[model samples]
Structures are given as C-alpha cells and as structure tokens.
Target: MKTVAAIALYSFREAVRNKILYSILFFAILLILLSVVLGSASVHQDSRFLLDIGLFSINLFGDIIAIFLGITSVFQEIERKTLYNVLSKPIDRATYFLGKFGGIAMTLAVQLLLMAAALSATLLLRGGSVDLQLLGAFWLTYVESVMIASFALFCGSFSTPYVSGFITLGVWLIGRLVQELAAFLDKVEEPASRHLLQGIVALAPDLNFFTITTQLTYGYPVGLAYFGAVTLYGLGYIVVAMGAAIFIFRRRDFI
Candidate 1:
C-alpha cells in the first residue's frame, strides 16, 4: 500500500511535468473561449452552448490525456529501464499497476475540475446559469475518462505506446457505437451475424451512459439511479482493465 501510494505520487508529479498536460489545458481554455463565438453561430448549439462546449472539452482533453499519458506510463518506464529498477525493490507488479492507474485517475480529476471551471466561466459570461444537475453530468464524464485511462493502461502493459493509444481510442469509438451497432444488427436478416454482433455489444463498454452532454445543454434532469448505475459500471470496467494490466505486466520482460 505504501509503495502504491508513493509510486502514485511520483507518477502524478511526472504527469504534471509532462508538457502535453499543459498543452491540453491550453487547448481546453481555447475551446472555452471559442464557445462564445460558436454559440453565436447557431442558437441550437451556442446560446446554451456552454454546457456542450464544456462537456466536449472534457471528453476531448480527457482522451488526449489517456492516449498521451496513460499509454506511455509503463512504456516510458520500460524504455528508461525504470521498471526493472522499481521491480527490484520490495514492490510487486500489482502495486506498480495500481499506482499508475491511481495516478492517472487523479490527473483526470484535476483536468476535469479545470475544464468545468472554464466552462462555468464561459457560461457566466454568456449570461447563462448552470443547474445543479450539471455537476452530476460533469462528474459522470470524468468517471468515464478514468475508465478509458484504465483501459489505455492495460493496453500499455504489453504494447508500444502508439499501439496502446490506438487500441484505447478504438475501444472508445466502439463503446460509443455499441448500442447503435446492436440496433442495426437487429434489423439485419442474417441471424448468425446479428447474434455475433450482439455478443460484441454485451462485451463493449456502454459509453452512452456517460454521455449526458445533450441533456446538460437542454437542461434535463439526470436521475440518481442512472448516475449510480453509470458510476458502478465505470468502476467495474476500471477494475477489470487494471486487473488485466497487472496480469500482463507480471509476464513482461523488463530486462
């Protein structure tokens, strides 16, 4: 536990030092600023556009963090031979895996907060007021980002950073389309093929549950049960991804 916490703190510091973190922040701020211009273009997306802009910023930047930071976490250590050095200590593989996951999760939380604040500022300036449910909506988005980070970490365990990043991105895309694909499959006449698609749907992460940006933009109530279920699902996926990362890392040759 001590090792996990210590490593997590160290990883967090490293993540902060990485230039990409700041770059993403800059881009997020840019998005917030542009929201005004974007909102003015189309009332459908802009007048109440702060929420959508903010949610999009979080989702886009969160994805950047997952791909850039999460995928490189372990591979960077291995490239520098730090993984071997760390493992030589009293630390176990699981602690190392969990530490990376914890550190990235913490980083996502910080990023989410910054994005939310920026979004709120834009909304305030635009003469818009956020409902309380907006907070829950943002939290759900953050949770989803953490889940993506975990899956990215798992891919990083055995693959190159590029491969891991691409795989994580693919998973995110698949999760987004899983429901749509299922519906499409149901309309198809090929029973066997449709059933195969159904199986994939069951395995894919239900990303739609995390995407409440539409509701936020239109000021819809996000039910407590829905939020709880989404949170539970995100945590469950995070655990599974982290566990897989540990399993793969245990067999990794860092020498």
Candidate 2:
C-alpha cells in the first residue's frame, strides 16, 4: 500500500511538471472561451447552445489530454531510463503500473475539473441555468477518456510511444463506430465474413455508451442505469488493459 501510494505521488508530480500538460490546458481554456462567443449567435435559447458547446469543448479537450499524456506516461519513463531507477527500489511491477495508472487518472481528473470550471463560468456568463445532467455528462466523458488512457498504457507497455499514440487514436475511432460496424456486418451477404466482423465488433469497446453529449445538450434524462453500466464497462476494460501492461512490463529488460 505504501509503495503504491508513494509511486503514485511521484508519478503525479512528474505529470504535473510536463510542458504538454500546460500547453493542452491552455488550449482547452481557449476552446471553452470560444464556445461562449459562438453560443451568442444562436437564434433560439442561446443558453442551451452555449451550455452544449461548453460541455462538449471540455470533453473534447479532456480527451486530447488523455491521449497526449497517457500514451507517453510509461513509454517516456522507459525511454529516459527512469523505470530502471524506480524498479531498482523495493517496488514491484504491478504496483508500479497501478501507481502510474492512478497518477494518469488523477491528472485527467484535474484537467477535467479545470475544464468544467471554465465551462461553468462560460455558461453563467451566458445566463444559462446549471443542470445536473451536465455534471453527469462530464463524469461519463471522464470515464471514456480513462478507458482510452488504459488502452494507450497497454500499448505503450510493449511499443514505441509514437506507435502507441497512433494505435490508441485508431482504437478510439473504432470504438465509437463498433455498433455501426456490427449493423453493417449483419447486412453483408457472406456468412463467414459477417460472422468475422461480428466477432471483431464484439471485441472492440462500445464507446457510444460513454457519449452523453447530445443528451445533456438537449435536456434529456441521463438515467442512473446507463451510468452504472458505463462505469462497470470502464472498470472492466481498465483491468484488462492494466493486466496486459503489467504482464509485459514484468518481463521487460531495461539493461
């Protein structure tokens, strides 16, 4: 427990010190501000339009941070020989991996909160009423980003940072389209190919579950059941990805 906490703290500090973190954050704030400006052009109920833009901007920027930093977390440590020094201590591979994951998760949470604050301020300025659904949407967005972060970490455990980045982005795009792919596969004439496509879609993550943008924007009810299911799904994927990362890292030779 002590080892995990210590490592997590160190990782958090390292992530905070990175220039990429601040650069993305700056751009995210800019996006939130820009959303407010664009919202003024709406002809009807400009508050709804502004609120939607604010929430979506935050979610989009948070995702960009997760992909940029999460993919490099482990890979950067390994590349810089920092992993060797850390491993030379009393820490185990699984503990280290979990700590790194925790650190990245915390980093993402901080970024999301910052974005949320910016969004809130933007909405308030536009005379929009704050809705609890927006908060729920933010929570769901965070889960989705964390899921992507775990995938990136899994890839980084065995591949170069550049490769992991590309793979993570590709998987994210595919995850959002998995349902569409499944539907298309069902319509295919060939049985064997259809079955193969079905199998592939099943293996892919269903990112749509985490998407609540349209719902929050339109004042739709985001029920608790969907939140529960998405949370569980995110946990399941994170566990699988972290397990794979640890398995690879345990056998890595840093000599």
- What are the Cα lDDT values of the candidates? 0.84, 0.83
How well is each residue in 1-255 modelled by candidate 2, as lDDT tens digits? 888888878888999998978888898888778766776776765777776667666767777788877788888888899888888898789999999988888989988988888888777777776677777778888998888888999998899888988998888888979988987985898989888887879888988888787777676898888888899998899899889989998998886
Deviation (Å) of 25 in candidate 1 = 2.1
Total clashing pairs in model 1: 1
Error of 2 at 221 (Å): 1.3
Worst lDDT window (10 residues) for model 1? 43-52
For candidate 1, the per-residue lDDT at 152 reads 88
Query: Ten consecutive residues with minimal summed lDDT in candidate 2?
Result: 44-53
RMSDs, each prediction?
1.7, 1.6
Model 1, span 1-255: residue lDDT tens: 888898888888888888878888889889888878877888556657767776888787876776677898888888998777788888888998888888887788888888888887778777777667878878888888899898889899989898998899988988989888887885878888878888878888988889888876666777989889999999999889888889988987766
Give candidate 2 regions above 4 Å deviation: 190-192
- Give the true-structure RMSD of model 2: 1.6
Model 2 residue 21 lDDT score: 82
Residue ranges of candidate 1 with Cα displaced over 4 Å = 43-45, 189-192
In model 1, the Cα lDDT at residue 149 comes to 90
C-alpha lDDT of candidate 2 relative to the true structure: 0.83
